[model samples]
Target: MRVETIFEMTSPYRDSFRIKGFRFGNGEKTLAIAGPMRGDEIQQQYICSQIVRRLTMAEQHGRISEGKSILVIPSCNPFSMNVSRRFWAMDNTDINRMFPGYSQGETTQRIAAAIFSALEGFEYGIQLASYYVPGDFVPHVRMITTGYETLDTAKLFGMKFVSLCKPRPFDTALLNYNWQIWNTKAFSVYAGCTSRIDSTAASETVDAIMRMMQAAKILTKTVTLSPAYEPAVVDESELLHVKASHAGIFYRLKSPGSSIESGDVLAQIIDPYNGQCLSEVKSPADGIVFFAHNQPLVFENGLIFMIRGM
Candidate 1:
């Protein structure tokens, strides 16, 4: 096992910003795993830390395959993480939106360029990712539907689902998309929630990552058990969004990963001042809850749940 600083920026007011990577085994660049690029992604960071810990143990026990090297970076933007900000502290920019970046463009661009430079030339890239929305997701592997993507390889992660995302205009700058264009098989892995750790979901993600490494022959041993699920393939557009009709305090009854039938009571909107139930949100179709709003408050027409129709 080896640790190295892949990117660094000096600061007069604070500690230098450094992106450190933990490498296991020695040989070809086989895989690269990255954690949070956002400050509030505590759950994402935790998942990557667990991957690093397990890989460290695997290297010690000679479980990492010979002629295979894997790099795991636990966090990319620790400066923002330190202050609990969601984006770049100085400019309020997202590091994730600047990928395959310009070295001379801006602070985040330089950081992105440095990090992406270090990440290149790997057979696989896995990012412990979070949703842009504040919500809980059923743990799954997601991929941008670049022409080079293959769902078969993504299914190797052994998560419950594999989401094929149809990229929007802004997606061209994403690390996962750029990695795919650069001939790397990239995957975005989501845990159940962000900002707080979910032990059950975190354990499942760690197991899935190790299982993928073992399947790719980068590791000789893995902590994963017998395959627990056959991944359901879903396009991102297929999800049914259930929205809040009234602005109020939200009371949710369903969570991510729950199976629901049409007309099931999903939630209720409560009048905070009067303590009266203003409205009830119900499921419109039989499906699995792919995502559920995590916050206690909601606005009219705000997304509450995204169901994967069965």
Candidate 2:
């Protein structure tokens, strides 16, 4: 295993910030896995760390395929991670929203440019991604419906679900979208949690990545984990959104991965000052809960749940 600083910047008030990459094997740039562009993505970073550790062992054991290489960047914004801030500490800009960035642009844009330059030519790219909202997902692999995306390849991860979302205008600047536009097959792996680590989900994510590598012939041998399961493929239209009508303290009655029927009580919004139940959020469709808001508070019209319709 070889470790290198892919990007570095000399900070005026603190130590130099460096984005490190761990390389395994030698030859073709077969795969690149990135993690934690945002500081609060603890689970994303943790999953990437596990991938690096496993790859290191595989490299040492000569299990990595000959003439193929894998790179893992466990954290992209270490400065923000150090301070526990979600975006750029100084400007509050998101590194993820600055993909295929300009070198002369703002801090996050420059950082994105540097990282993308180093990762551009890989055959496949995987990102440990989190939802925009603070919530728990049902652990799945997601891909943009860019022409370059491969749904078959995404299913190789063997997660519970494979979601394909049509790219919106704002998605054009995201790493996965940019990677696809650059002719790289990019995928985003979403574990169950973001800021908090879910050990079972993390393990499942690591296993899924390993399974994908093995399936791609990038890994000559497989890790001794359980066999990968078949995943259900769903498009964005199949997901049903549940929104909060009133702002208040939020409490969830149903968790992600739970089965739900129409009109089932999914959560409750409580009046913060009056200690009264403000609203009872109910499921609008018979489906499986794909995501659920886990945070303590909710705003009016906030997306609190996503149900994958049966």
lDDT of all predictions, in order shown?
0.92, 0.92
Which candidate's TM-score is highest?
1
Candidate 1 local lDDT, residue 164: 93
As for candidate 2, its clashing pairs are none
Off by over 4 Å in 2: none
Estimate the overall C-alpha local distance difference test score of candidate 1: 0.92
Model 1, range 208-288, lDDT digits (tens) per residue? 988888888898955545465789998989999999999999999999999999999999999999999999999999999
Clashing pairs in 1: none
lDDT of 2: 0.92
TM-scores of all candidate predictions against the true structure: 0.98, 0.96
